[model samples]
Target: MNFALGFKTTMGESGSMEALEKQLICPICLEMFTKPVVILPCQHNLCRKCASDVFQASNPLWQTRGSTTVSTGGRFRCPSCRHEVVLDRHGVFGLQRNLLVENIIDIYKQESKRPLQPKAEQQQLMCEEHEEEKINIYCLTCETPTCSMCKVFGAHKNCEVAPLQTIYNRQKTELGDGIAILVAGNDRVQAVISQMEDVCRTIEVRITEVHLPKAQL
Candidate 1:
């Protein structure tokens, strides 16, 4: 089935707000629509910045600074509907309530066809373009963490070597869920340690009080 039909079918299960959003998205940006600017005359809508960029690319003369005239700006047409829409009279707004509806519909479809984690893990591992030094060890090819000697003499030759820290940061961003899980675990550990410290302090105080009373008696 087409995306529109599937979108509608999934949206039927969602609330009213979702149904309105499915039509509001800019075809370029797959995410929620932003700065929705409607084309004049045709009444079709596109993201403001996206539409301008499209127009500029379509007409090379539009890019030259101070070279454009009033007529030059009006000559550009909408790429999608091929309709004439002038930028001067049009206004931009951040009306994203309709965009949210489409997101909800898409999210529902993705949830319904959830991928099996175990099955995904069973798939073959893809090879990285960077030269392989060892089983999993990477050959940086002297571009980053790897040294010049390693690039020339070692298994790592001229290859696209990225910094280890950069790789680590990207992985962290991608595995945000894993980071949340780790944070929760660390919090639990801290709570347990705090409780144990309190218990130890109470035990020491009780011992001191009991011993002094017994010695005096």
Candidate 2:
């Protein structure tokens, strides 16, 4: 089962936290998976709504005349691996719900809501050549972190330098904007999932009232 983590910037081991958060995001929606997540036959997990969207786009006439049944029997490609997913009469609902992944999302949400604990001061990154100096500047020309000594007389002496704090703040803003876009995409996928859930409910009721009783006879 595929799972993605949703993370907010906080103090302590920033690099590891960022990498962990990236793993939790859905490849299709590029956001945390919404409820009713499903696992494909190929073993990848996608938000049910996102999967439904992919299916509908591939088979435009699948929902024609309000019918859930696919007459011609077509398949949709997986967004990540591009593996073909064959559709049954129930379509997306036929795929299994990934209980493990859903539970992880629930746990992540609970943890994220809690207040962050105070962390110890992080160690400064040191320059290779001038081990005594902390890296405080970014060499724009070489696109690498450097110390003041490097800027003054080392390899980056001719390169333009910017304060590391300035670059950090800019990157933080860009990450925030990216998260916003992903959230917006998730909202759209949620709507599609809702529609598919309604369709599945209708199909289940029909089966119970019509097919089951006739079979018992």
Candidate 3:
């Protein structure tokens, strides 16, 4: 009898932990929510880009009569729960995106405490051609850093090359686009959240109206 009682208690504890895990998990990834957003109808939440990325990655490739290559587009399904979400519904997609963005920003603000370090300080790559110099400039075609001498060589003869700084800036811009996407998603969610608050107020007023009549009776 004692064993049985202990088993039930352990099971109960496990169940509670599972519930907490579900709350933290990303709806899109079915893992911890990286960037969380609340969805409509069910009000279930998910990571913002996770859902959209899943949709884009899995779309149908039905090419009509003449097309040689197939094109895929996003599906309107929640990433975590696999629930069908109607993207066309006014404010729904925007709200979910906003929530995710806000969560990501909050997380970023917390992590920003770690100061940025310079790459050159960390990497110690020496140019093979010029034994004395660090090969910071990269050849585009050869796809390798060359000291001034290697820059004139075989594969890099006509290829375009640039200093590490230029490459860093270009890569940063590309990464910035991804960050911008998250920010945009967050903005949409914020707009809907304001609307949701208004909705809550309306419901409260209606509830009071219903209660007052009963109190009078």
Candidates in order have lDDT scores of 0.54, 0.81, 0.59
Clashes of each: 2, 3, 6
Candidate of highest TM-score? 2
Displacement of the residue 169 alpha carbon in candidate 1, Å: 46
| Model 3 misplacement above 4 A | 1-124, 128-133, 141-146, 154-158, 173-181, 204-208, 211-213
Model 3 Cα lDDT, one tens digit per residue, 1-217: 5743443344333344455455566655566656445554456665656655654455544222453324332246654465766543222334445454445445434333434445565677787656877777778777766765666764466778899668878889999998999999999999999999999999998888888866575
lDDT of 2 by residue, 109-156 (tens): 665556655455556888999999999999999998899999999999
TM-score of 3: 0.31
Candidate 1 regions exceeding 4 Å error are 1-15, 64-71, 86-217
Q: Which candidate comes out best when scored by lDDT? A: 2
Runs with alpha carbons beyond 4 Å of true place in candidate 2: 1-17, 64-72, 121-217
Model 1: lDDT equals 0.54
- Name the 10 consecutive residues with the lowest summed lDDT in model 1: 89-98
RMSD of 2: 26.7
Tell me how far candidate 3 lies from the true structure as C-alpha RMSD in angstroms.
28.7
Error of 1 at 59 (Å): 1.1
Sorted on lDDT, best first, the list reads 2, 3, 1
Error of 2 at 59 (Å): 0.8
